[model samples]
Target: MTTWNLNGMKHHLFFCNGGSCTKKGAEEVVEAMRDEIKLQEADVRIHTTRTRCQGRCEDACVITVYPEGVWYKEVTPEIGRRIVREHLVGGSPVEEHISYTYEDELAARPDTKEGQSKTKRKEAQTK
Candidate 1:
């Protein structure tokens, strides 16, 4: 395996390839994203990783972009390409597909499916 030197990179994207995400067509999304990156000549400005379950199966095909902590869900190949074209390159996030983002803490994007339980269990809360 080749170790990467992430120097001068602007963003790191984690593409979920867990069972649920795969079932939802993550492979196509991944390929589309990669191809778009190459087509747009952003290989050095961004890095991508294939990850296991991000615990957001309800939002299958989830993708997380770091340095900004923005998460996008239910991504199709077209949206995957757009994420590379718009967000990674154009300096603006794609609003409609966003699932979560970080602003001091992880904040869910409005109207997105819950990635965690809406209510904490009483016993768990006690801990």
Candidate 2:
């Protein structure tokens, strides 16, 4: 058997195939992505992985790509193919499908006491 280093891969893709996502056609998305990758002969550059719940039940059939750390929501088979062709091959992210990014998470965090107070005030106002 030949050992491969995961770090060497250019893109690592994870498809959430858990119960919620599967109900949303996660299996079909996975199949489409695999087919596209094989068609493009990108197996050497991209690695695909299956994962359980990503905790975004509302965004079922989520696809996350790294090391860019972009999370795409509500992925259909067609969207999967586009992601492979446009994002993986063309080196561009499918902005329409992107639900969130690592930068979004960072920006949402309240780093200072003043920021935390402001966030709490906003939440209270919404309620």
Candidate 3:
């Protein structure tokens, strides 16, 4: 395995490759994002990792960028590229695709999709 030099990485992207996201074309999004990062010349400051389910299966193809802690949902290939250009390169979050963002805490944006069952987390929280 190659050990990465991540000293200059400002953003860590967690690309979900879980079952639901795989069905939703997550691999393509990952590739598109990586390609765009290179094309936009933002690779030095950004690092990416593929992860299992992030518990937002309803919002398949989730891409979470850290430090800023922004979670983007329904990321198509085009949106993946836009994330690299606008957010990674331009230092701005893509507002339209954001499902959740962390301020002092994790805040679900108004545009967050409503399919996730509240009962699930409520049970986990109560446990």
Worst 10 residues of 3 by lDDT: 112-121
Residue range with the least summed lDDT across 10 consecutive positions in model 1: 114-123
Clashes of each: 0, 0, 0
What lDDT tens digits, residue by residue, belong to model 1 across residues 84-122? 999999988888888788743464554755443223333
Between candidates 1 and 2, name the one with more favorable TM-score.
1
Per-model TM-score, in order, reads: 0.83, 0.77, 0.83
lDDT tens per residue, model 3, 1-127: 1327888888989999999999999999999999998888778888899999998898888999998988899999999999999898898888888888775345467655543333455666789
Alpha carbon lDDT at 2, candidate 2 = 27
Q: Which of 1 and 3 is the better model by lDDT? A: 1
Q: Quote the lDDT for 1 in model 2.
A: 12
Clashing pairs in 1: none
Model 3 score (lDDT): 0.84
Give the runs in model 3 whose Cα sits over 4 Å from its true position: 1-3, 112-127
